[model samples]
Target chain A: MGKPKKEPKIKRKTYIDTWRFLFQIGAFIAILVNPFLNYYFHVKVIQGWYQSIAFGHLWFVSPLEGIEALLITKIIYMPWIIGMTLPIIVALLLGRVFCSWICPINFFYEIMDRVHKKISKRSYYKRKPLFTLPRWILWVALVGELMLAMIVGKPIFVFLSPPGLVGREIMMAVFFHTLALEGIIVLIVLTTYLISQRFFCQYLCPLGALLAFIGAKRRLIIVQDMNTCHQCGFCDRACPWGIYPSRGEAEGIYCTNCGSCVAVCPFNARKFVFVGFTPSSEKLKLEKVPSGRQ
Target chain B: MKKENTSPKDSDKRNGEISRREFLRVLVGFSLTLPELAHAKSKFFSSPVHTNALRPPGAVPEDLFAGKCVRCGRCAEVCPYHCIEMLDIRHGLYAGTPIIYVDKIPCYLCMECTKVCPTGTLKPIPQEETRMGLAVVDKYRCITWKGEGICRSCYNACPYKDKAIYLDRLRPVVNKDHCTGCGLCTAACPVTPKAINIEPIYSFKVSKR
Candidate 1:
């Protein structure tokens, strides 16, 4: 009788994971040093003196703001109009992988998680529904704010934005002013993140949620092979968002495409796969057989 | 053998059920309270200050005010003159927005803030296109107008080569039309109280007005 084939073992480390970590560290250092560089060196001189380039401008034009601004301003600048619509296009292509890999806030959240694990002596931390409730509430508020801006002529959400808060700190620091209030605000945000892995990305971030919805149906989804899964559930345990990869639907709305689960998986069952969009499939096929199998 | 094979399927079915329930709970919860939350949000929307009334001419569009602004401090970081300061009005929802007050630090209309706005919040306007507001001379505070002394600081400091503050036979008078409202004149006016001030012109119509 032929010997039964054993399930393959997956490597713990991957290139993407290494790159993600390096990017996170680099971004954090850059954010910390940004103020000093602006003040002393005048490295990237903006027209307005001493103003950090980050806060004064929008990274992208928000659709909600763009449509509302149209009614009042009457002058629809095309470039900004185009910039706001680009996120929807990008989301359709890549699924909010940006949130997991590139967001500076997510990098901070990961750091906070490590600290939380050390201080609380708990490896697994789950967020309460009460915390998640605010995300949806905020989204509703954003949409409502836009509608009101259209009817009543006002934009409300700009004030409470996290980016705006950070911008204020950078500006104050550049001017040699005390950033105590900004520091306190940052602490509150960091504390919330420490309690829950990706607390803002999963729950509070409207952009992340919007991208998730747009990309959910895309074929390129993270999947696991049930037959090969050792039920070690390391992938499940490693998931920052607490998703069970073995369950076969990596289509969970909260997935940030961070690849932590892929990094820690002992068996090479889990892999990113495209279902419909792309004709060819590329998977990280495992080479070594599982240890304890006949 | 049959029981072993069936157990995995049963477990899969159970997991599917749980997942469905979780998804439904999240969806329903979001749907039910969305309207109420939006209603509450509408109350906080402050009307846009009119463009003409805006003391400065380059009033950014309202849509540019949405929360997509990453606020990386790039604008403040790159400013050559160190004029812009990000304000944190943590009270009543205006907690983190960056507001430039001309009195403390006036914008030079250099277009640096607009250039760095990656998100189009600060739409880039060219230097020639940029208009903040008109500078109006407060005659009561002017040394020459008040007859305290013949201080021509405002006229000398006017960046507009033509000089918006002209001495009408050497009695300091402000030509409101030519005033670009750069605040150089305000900063230069030599008086105990100071004279020149740039007030926002109201362009958009207001309900109260």
Candidate 2:
């Protein structure tokens, strides 16, 4: 995995590589215009998908509010079933793909990471993707906090979930005609990325953590052909999350499926593959150290 | 400095002090401490809704509604007339939840918001069956009841027409059983003090139930 066996024919990736870029733009446009149009054109609001595009109708944040509302009001708010199901299914399939493709804040984080590299000439992340309490621990923390608050009668996370804040910020901008404090928090988070590699996504963002937990059991993973992998370690250097791509392990929960490593690989060894599709991929699972290492 | 040569990834492979499952146990212990701070459990549950505010048609009773309502603003977004507004911090525990200001913009009875409610916060009752509240006529405030000018506007504005309100002896009288309490009549009342008003179902008072 150290030296190139000739220059490895780097082939262009298939459609999946750029689909995230298209999805990010699509979601951004929907989030930006849904509120303004829903307000001004309530006449045509009619019954459909476009309606939930409104600020308060944030699909992502709506589901999280159930615990708060149930605890505070004792009303179960069953409609949240719409808000929770699809994203979760995607997480189980692709593993936090929303962080890379749809999170507007993450779009800004990438720009900041680029700027940081230009200025400091060193990896902003001094360490590899820091193995925190794994995704499940954080997921429990979120649910426990919600249940605890519900029993106690004070709804939490309503004011705290970042996606909800993003919707609020967008709504205030469209309707109130003034920026609110939430925008400043977003700005602070974006600024943090310039100083630390993906600080907000890594240490904070409960929603991202939720997806990470669900995504822990995902099927699609970046596979590297050992025959072609000249471990010049460029893929590891290219990872924004600081994962060691040369490690040739099944991806961890933290992988955003952004495929930056695939794009950066000079050798065409790295490509996303559905592990169970072919019989041979059973061996491609993430390589763990022997059991006693811990 | 002595020559040391180990790849950074290999040297950092030692697992940290806490295993993922073990940390969950510690976190769960912390989770148990939260309910002790719990106090607002009954705030939105038992009705005679503290604020006495008008909600969208099919809204749950206030006491239980507050706990169930996430206040994501979806109801306001989907309302065809845009009559719904999220109450701000001034509403305390009910902040960001939907309320219909009867005089500013009354419920139009289009029944669109009910269809899109992601949660059961707004019960999906049909327009004919909706009992948002009962329309009560303040006879003392009505010029018609005072034997002055005959104002039939409340009766005329009632979506249920004769079923919800009727012209009796040239005065508008509300039939509570037939009334949806949409406040259309209240919004149309021409009398300066307003002759007809809808009593919100959850208004804190003698239980309407």
Candidate 3:
């Protein structure tokens, strides 16, 4: 008897992939033009201008805080404010495509990962010791930041901020303060980046930790059709955050929703499915297939 | 029989040593840059002296100190010019919070440093409202009043228009009422120990209105 043939998988482009590519290109242009824009317009222009204004002040350059400030300040009709908040709601419905595809830092990391892979010739390993350290450290830092803000009546995060550092560097370069102290800080940050991939986001970013905590649930994840997985492990290899997709739904704490796994899955079985509230019975059925193969 | 690979613990120990070395290197580099960072932070965080306090009523604030005020100098930079700078010394504070020494340099009221502050540390006061201190002219060295010679430099520089220092028969007379205490006469005086000098105006306290 002939072996049963597997159902043909459909191949199509995901919105997540398109969005991620476009955002990365946009960020690059923004970084390049920030100086001229700031000088000519007399705006404290940065990549996170919308977020900064929303936050009442530039608080650590994250859109999340800016969104929180908007909610607190009750400023309506801000397009960027709307843009930032919509994705979280969408994440609840469609899963964390925002982290994987929309975050500028994540986009930078993916590009870095490709370059690292090409240079090293060794396959990038997942679940390294340092990889798990960031989430815990970030949690601790967030608690400390809140306490310090209360005690000092000042936003302490602005001092050691990555985005602030980036803004200061751009300002120094444009204004010819390259010999100034802000210029030196830019050099230190660049050196740190050279040592590790996504050093700021994966390890030190309190904002990323906060987002991950909010999105940590198995129901909202990218699922695979086990019958078509083929154990090729393409999804596992493609995961930038070091998630093992073949091991089933993501743990959610580490997943940034960058959608790299979904884009690179050759079998086209991977689907970002929101599992909470109501579990997809179809996914449960697919999970019951025998371990070795179809 | 092939040799088995080392466990995760063994590899972790080796990586730990490398990371420790890197941490030390970063710490050393940070320490080397500490002095400059402290200076910049302190400059941005300190409070500035109110030079308008030395001026008389209705006197223009900018006429006191001239070219000497580039606004980039470290005086305003380290003034602790913030809301917090005020609150720091509010409770039975011994002498008031730090302000500029307007008697020596006179508050030119340039507002240059206020424009460059990143954290709004130095609140930008308008050129009209920034009162540092009232100016008091010393009559001892006045050429017109003391009969040293005919020097009307102070009379010419005074922006009050009616003249803070008027010449009465080639002798200088400071009209205390129209003087405005701007200290322009003091800065423009061509005498050692300054024939005209600005004294701190203690009576005209800054009213919020």
Candidate 4:
């Protein structure tokens, strides 16, 4: 033998991206199935959709809806607070995973993103400069929506919310044998994928903005093993949200935990690591990695 | 190529730091538009009341219902009679909000809609306590009133038959206090344009009858 045989490295079997995709698909099917169960079978076991859902006696409202009710009604609604608990805790830990793993609108948006990527190869497709909007614009939009809701004294943004519309439209189609006029809003937002990936989630969604605000100091975040990373930039290309994980530009609020970067990393260097457990230098060294790569 | 890669991120950081001019500009624009937006919301987004259309039993007054309702579609999903339908986009701000088309399908007063309401917009109330609307019988349209024939359809169809509707000289008479306005009579009425109709008395959209 010319040299001792090298041992093959064992790859981790579970792909985070695959789990995320399954959850997204499951959420889409659940929206469709909830109404069907109610209409045909009269199963009152599970009711409602993303905006609010009730499981038998236990019920929960979306955090955005909860906050709107709180502000508009100006009363402490305990049930809404109770309903919002699980989502808030998840956001606090996982950093907008609902956007990637659960939102029905995002499920459709991901499909549109794939189509956009394929068609962009043609000369005619117009692509917006990636990540041009300042992240605070999301906060501004959110605050503006809250103010509008208070002014209108209604849950005004729910009318424009894509996820809300998708759920309500499906319920309308199944139970009432007609679709609502607001279904047009979902169509319009999906069409924007041709201009930019995740345009609605990034720039416009008040619900996403609220979740991002709650997840700003999220525990689980993408951290690179600087020693192993070769500055290959595969993560940058893979991240449809335009988050550059290889360059350590994984802004906590913007990263949806889609795991596209993790899936694309040839070196197996990028990972979801809790910032609390990681050393201060490893966490703070995000700034130094780009200079070294350059 | 690297410059292109790095520049947007750098510019993004610079932009994130709110400039004084930018702050002032946004403040001015928001304040100027606030009043106008509020006025338009009331003027244009007001819910319209339709005849034979009633909110599910236990619904709050119409004005508060819009603000409190999250449009969850739970009420429509749980109706055993399939009487509840959400208002479509044509209804403007009321779209996706639940309503009962009493003429087409009357609420059976299963009280399932009230139980599933996550918002207290539809307070959970018992069937006998339901104050959905008051059914009004059209004397001119009623067969007994016309002397065309003796009809007890409204009297027979009423859930609280003896209490809500009673036959007086073979003509159906409505007792407003007892009628839950479930609209079973309207659905059962064989006449065109219905011999009786449910009017949502609690809704601001409908003027006092």
Candidate 5:
């Protein structure tokens, strides 16, 4: 009987959140140990935190910090330019993946979200205070922060950024044997988790705003196949940002490419596709997929 | 939950290019910030000098330090002597920036902080070229200068002892030309309200503010 037509191996799908969680954990540990490595072990390889980090003489500065430094100082510092290239390029290609994958603050929020879910028995998005901010407010906030930095004559957000502050706290605790009062801002941001899961990322956070601005036309994006979608709200529920992948609302600027929606799709309708390539070929590829699984 | 369908035109109108609402928001943000900018002439955000607090060797001019420093803490991390300490929130705009409390811990002039500074906030320079500040012996407070006792504490502690500090008539005299302001003399001063203090004269232009 032709060897009983060996049963076609059914591939089990894995959630993308698994990879994302692993990355988040790795990033957190890296930040925690970076100062220790530099101070105690004399490892000169990696230095600094998320604000501006260096890898063995190569530097990488956050676009927001670089821009603020540029506006206030009005000097096109070479290191700032060299440091900003990788992040800007990554933003252009991947669409805010730094927010989802590397930001230490986001990792903390993810953990907080789990605890929140266990206690409340519902998603944070479903709670009250549905006051959604217009995306344009991000632009205003960015402009406002720049102006404040110029007036203040300092990188204002460096003092207030949660990830930077977290790293600074660790560094100071290690070197100085004390915590700076700036940890209060980190505490304040963390406490806001009781209100909403990603309140800072959505309404505040100029760094996220700057990244979203750079990644507005990102190449890698979540594209929905309408034919096979079945109008299921699973992706909508799965998205932490509250963008509706089913209703074609997942735009590049707001979407962090966390792949949560892709993970939760039971029908496998949502996928990360390079949309900037040949549109016709992409459409053909999407259409070739069967409508639904038996 | 009711699912509301967003048409392409609706999404485009809300998100595409610049809209009237976006312009209005920008206007509001500008209005809010412009007044603060005008008020900043009072120097509310500038770094103010604290007594006994000094920047590391090879530090940029005080005026440019705040704007240039990213506060990455690498300067503190690399200091073999661990003399660099980041300022806390109480320091206002200079919070998180590095400072050496000369009385608590003096810079040894190892030049390591300068080597690791990524921002050029602390410019790289040779050990002898470091011009943190000029150490000035407070004659009235000094034991030798005040004729309390012929104390050679500061002279003995000075890194460039014979050049930066010398005993004239068996009383220590600081030569400003040679003093690199490493602050070892200040830390070694055997008196409360230290006899030898770094005046931070090099940073006077901004520190005066």
Candidate 6:
């Protein structure tokens, strides 16, 4: 009732959103099936090509894994460069598209979001402008810790990622055929999502944070035309991450580019556009949608 | 009027209330803290890596290998003979890394694993030059050494029959100079608790001449 009813004549662009869903499901299935392929078929389909375009790389180690190896054991696997380069190029070009279009974690979080809507009558999310460090400051502390780990000779953040945990567990379960205690950590993350909406995405995930850091200047952005938007905040309710879409003007470091808010808008005020090439449209008429924090 | 019976379940279902966010903040903290407890166990215990673990050929020294290996399992997957086995987490720091249990499944040394190694955790050395380890025979336990009509099993099975293993008074004597330590002889030896075993290079550090 909060949003105005749309005219049936307006054909909504649902296929693009469906494309994202299909990519997500397809990516998730590819990851879930990959570890079993080598074990069952005795064939190397990918042939250690962990860094594929489909799911990207699931290898636990990367050239950018940093000095954790050199500092800890004084050795470097020079070939790990194969693992790091492609993802860095992707992040530089596309931003954190993985979180929205590829990450399996989002699928699980979506399920938890439904459970929360049913069981818990709260829509509380502690987000944006975290303390004084702007929401965009996702990678600084962890990256700093990574440098320090190399200097100190110990890897600290190796297992901190939920996607990495999921990848590791799926690979372990298929190859070893036993659900190890590591699965418990994955369960805890799932339960955490139930308790807090987008807490990990907004505040914690380092991989997403790293991508956000690299992709902050990306041209592809979610733009909301202030002239049309009611600012009724229905888009806020629809957003699983609970971010106000109107505030983005265009790009946001924290935005996963999931497009749920765009799908729900009755007025059709939002659109994903390339701002880098646009002449006058590049000048975004940004209106602060009252973060209500001050 | 004050709300008295506010259970956490019935707790304010809306934002703008600081308590619920604080509760969520605490739950997030709890999630991270739970993993920290598991980490503490590793801190107190010694590394679970086996002392005499015979790694696949082309593996770098153990100390360096742990840092370099991503354990993608390419070496094991490409092996013409499935002699390579990836260690479980029970093997401690080297978990998911490749290992060889020569007794259960001996390496034929086709050298495919070396070429398939993406990270060079296992170096790409040819089969002939691979010094995986040195095979040592115990004279006392060997059936041939007991004068029981010379089994000759170790001599026949050795890839380098004359250079690596040769008959001395009808009993095989291992020549350390020419042995590549593929463990074929150890596996082929027709004796329980095989008389010959590879002294894995990682177990003891020695200068190569």
Number of the top DockQ candidate: 5
The ten-residue window of minimal lDDT in model 3 chain A covers A47-56
lDDT of 5 by residue, A169-220 (tens): 9988877778988898888887776656677787788888888888988888
Tens digit of lDDT per residue, candidate 4, span B112-156?
888778877788888988977888889899899999998888888
Runs in model 1 deviating more than 4 A are: A1-12, A45-75, A116-153, A180-185, A193-195, A274-279, A282-294, B1-57, B60-75, B90-99, B114-130, B202-209
| C-alpha lDDT score of every prediction, in listed order | 0.55, 0.64, 0.47, 0.79, 0.77, 0.63
Clashes found in each candidate (C-alpha, N, C closer than 3 A): 51, 23, 32, 0, 0, 0
Task: Assess candidate 5 and give its lDDT.
Answer: 0.77
The DockQ figures for the candidates are 0.16, 0.20, 0.05, 0.30, 0.31, 0.21
Q: Report the lDDT tens digits of candidate 3 across residue range A145-195.
A: 555543543333433344444443443455333422433444564455554
Question: Mind giving the per-residue lDDT tens digits that candidate 1 earns over B1-209?
Answer: 99998898887665535576789999999999999777656533542232222222244533434333333445556666776555444323333344555655666667666766544446566554544656677777777777777877767777664556677866766666666666666666555455777655422323120
Docking class of 6: incorrect
Which run of 10 residues does model 1 chain B get worst, by summed lDDT?
B47-56
Q: Provide TM-scores for the models.
A: 0.70, 0.73, 0.51, 0.82, 0.82, 0.74
Task: State, as a TM-score between 0 and 1, how close model 3 is to the true structure.
Answer: 0.51
> Rounded to one decimal, what is candidate 2's iRMSD?
5.0
Better of 4 and 6 by lDDT: 4
Model 4 spans > 4 angstroms off: A1-14, A114-131, A277-294, B1-44, B205-209
User: Alpha-carbon error at A282 in model 3, in Å?
Assistant: 8.9
Check candidate 5 and list the clashing pairs: none
Candidate 5: which stretches are off by over 4 Å?
A1-11, A117-130, A277-294, B1-46, B206-209
Q: Which ten residues in a row have the lowest lDDT in candidate 3 chain B?
A: B82-91
Lowest-scoring 10 consecutive residues by lDDT in candidate 5 chain B?
B1-10
Error of 1 at A253 (Å): 3.2
- Candidate 5 structure quality by residue, lDDT tens digits, B1-209: 23345465476564557978889999999999987776664445555555567899888778777777888887887777788888877766787788998888899998987877766778788888877788877888988888878788888888998999999998888887789988999999998889788877776565321
**What lDDT tens digits, residue by residue, belong to model 2 across residues A161-185?**
5555566566656554655443566
Q: How would you encode candidate 3's per-residue C-alpha lDDT over B6-104 as one tens digit per residue?
A: 565565575535586789999999999999787756644432233323322222122112101111111222222211111111211111112333334
